[model samples]
Target: MKLKSFLSNLPARVILLIYSVIVLYPLLWTVTTSFKTTNEFYENPWSMPKSFQWTNYINAFKEASIGSYFVNSVLVTLLSMAICMILSFMAAYVISRYDFKAFRWMKKMYLVALFFPVAFKIVPLFQLLGDMHLLDSLFGLVLAYSATTIPFTIFLMAGFLESISKEYEEAAMIDGCSRFGVLFRIIAPMARSGMITVAIFNFMSYWNEYIMALSFITTESKRTLTLGIAYLMEVQRYATDWGALFAGLVIVMIPTLVLYALLQRKITAGINVGGLKG
Candidate 1:
């Protein structure tokens, strides 16, 4: 029995180790390359640098408007996430709790929208934004991001909300709580896990978003990290600065890693709870 149990777990552990190495290797390589000089990197592509060149990171920030890009990305991502959460939560609650005539149709519409690709709407979106005079603005990007994220956020939140017992709301009403009060004080608390799950998903999507940011943000200083990183590749065409490029890649990756480290546990728990209903 003991031997069987050990054998059963061994394969899973080995697979986990292999997957971890596969995911981490590129990140490790990028960080190591960032510390190498350009010549050293070409000569020893796979080896660690003999001397750590911390100046590459400094150069990356000085040469590129990395600081400004970072701030823009953060602001846009946060604003979009906040707006998406509130709008999705309210919409999901209505869809889940109400027995209106169009509730079923509304639910189906949102689900269908979730399957549609953003690329399909690009032309129309661009025209609309142009007409609104929102072209090439961070605020425009934020609005677009929020709109794109809402369908998925509503879908996920609706699933979680549907799983909740309506009795909780009724009980609150008996205690003289207003609908808004019950939602804010009780139902929202119960849906915390789902909210966190949606927030994390939206954050990751917006933070790494490249296509829309590329299309909408024209000014160099207004570009997001992904856009700024692309400029490094363009510069490399003239003379390859692999060290500086890798340094920039590392800088871009740090925020994402830090965010995941901070919120991964909450995200996992939220996913587990949310999946129970779906």
Candidate 2:
């Protein structure tokens, strides 16, 4: 009987196995290739390394200047993520809970804003940033990323806030909690999973972002990791180093992988529950 039940679920298990292999194979290939020497790679790209070249990672960091780009990316991603989430959260809460003039229209406008392709905004955005003298600066990139992400973030967080009960807000206010305190204490905590989802999604997006970085950042010193990776591609045009290239990719993938691993449970929780009832 047990074997029969297991067999009943066999199709689902088989599908999952296929999906997992599809998702993980490229990452596995990249990591293993990073350890192969140039000769080993040219000899047999599919085979395992005869001798692991840990120096690939060192060369990526030192010679390729991934070290500086790593710091730049970390700073830009964190700051932009923080600003975007905070602004999105506040806007979402207000739209969900309050009734004021143009409130419905405002939400509709944000819905429309979500459809505006970011690439379309580039010309005007770059011009505006140039006028403000923010081009090529980290702060400029932060502003650009935060603005680009806010509309969708608001759309997500508003639904999460709307799903929460109003009684909690009333109860907190009656206990002498200020509006800000209620948000920080009650609402924010209840919405933790949604916030984490947004943060992780946007962090990864900004961390791996290339287009905006390419358009806005011209100075080599201000380049992001994504931009630095592009530089490696440019170097390859002159002299290809597949090992270091793969090593650089592994370096780029590591932080995102570690962050998601740490917060994997939070993602499932967000999908499972919108908000607490009480």
Candidates in order, TM-scores: namely 0.94, 0.94
- For model 1, what is the error of residue 213's alpha carbon versus the real structure, in angstroms, after optimal superposition? 0.9
In the range 19-121, model 2's lDDT, one tens digit per residue, is 9999999889999999998889889988999888999999999999999999999999999998999999999899889977687688888889989887898
- In candidate 2 the C-alpha lDDT for residue 116 amounts to 87
Instruction: Supply the global lDDT for candidate 1.
Output: 0.87
Q: Model 2: number of clashes?
A: 0
* lDDT for each residue of candidate 1 in 1-278, tens digit (9 for 90 to 100): 99999899999999999999999999899999999998898797999899999988887888766778889999999999988899989999999899787987888888899887878767777888999999999999999999998988988898888878999999999999998998889889999988887887788899899989888889987899899899878988887667888888998888778878998888888877763353
**Model 2, runs deviating above 4 Å:** 275-278
Worst 10 residues of 1 by lDDT: 269-278
**Residue 10 displacement in candidate 2 (angstroms):** 2.5
* Residue 41 in candidate 1, Cα distance off native in Å: 0.6
